[model samples]
Target: MASTIISKDKFQFTDTIREHLAFGIVLTCLFLFLTSAYTKIEEHDRFMNGLLKVAFISHYAWLISWTVPVAEIVVSLFLIIPKTHKWGLYGFIGLMMVFTIYIGSMLLWSEKLPCHCNLLIEKLSWGEHVVFNLAFVGLAAFALWLIKNNQYKSLIKQNDKY
Candidate 1:
């Protein structure tokens, strides 16, 4: 019988970097995305109401609102999981795209509506909002590139041979 050892180098550089980047991005996004909710815990109801209006307030609104933070945490964990992280990264990219669009649309559509949830809106403007969204788009693009690269082929083959 022959002895063999599996090592981290078995995976291609692209896959390794993407996997790590995906995990990092998920954590960063979860923290940055939910920051408003965390900071405005005092106004949780208003925050929920805003989302409810955008997403339709049905019987599930109450539960969904409360679970959103928890759900973000779960998704972040999934992105960090070795077996499930690839697919989870794809989902994370999609989520970021949707959020970018949603926030951008809101900014464009509302010219003078009273800001509800953003605590530091007095310092914000339409341009700043767009710039913020653009930053998210850039991050999403980097993550998406990794997903499309398909960098695991080498690692998978190396493992099979070993």
Candidate 2:
């Protein structure tokens, strides 16, 4: 007995957009996992200086405790699976946008000689931080642009010629 394949025309190019965005988002977040671990060992002073930056915020510790590592881990897995990749990209974009804002805030407030926020933070000065985040924002914006122009979204706008 032989098995036959059937095509139902379920959804067009949904997988492509998901793959592109997922690829970008996951590779981007990989920087986080590497940076977090790298700074702790390779450079201590910069790391300490960064923590000093956030030390005054009462909730900072808890935020770090739960948000950073967990987000890094969860998103990594979520993005790896094809079924979850689309939604995962959505979540990743949202989180990264929010992070860009935080980076912007740090740059704006640097006049007070505010701490850099961590050792990895030392890798980029205030000006550098803003530039880095803007670059990330640009990446996400491009992904959105691609998604909007994608076959799935645009194909839906066309008339069936059959």
Best by lDDT: 1
Which tens-of-lDDT digit does each residue in 52-122 have in candidate 2?
56634434644554465466456656656755655555666676676667666655654444443335566
| Residue range 1-162, candidate 1, lDDT tens digits | 122334554554556677677557656655554554454455667756666565333356567566655554565666556676556656656655664565666666744433433464436665566576567657756765665565556567779997
Q: What is the TM-score of each predicted model, taking all chains together?
A: 0.54, 0.56
Q: What is the C-alpha lDDT of each candidate?
A: 0.58, 0.56
Clashing pairs in 2: 46-119, 47-119, 50-117, 50-118
Which whole-number lDDT from 0 to 100 does residue 72 have in model 1? 49
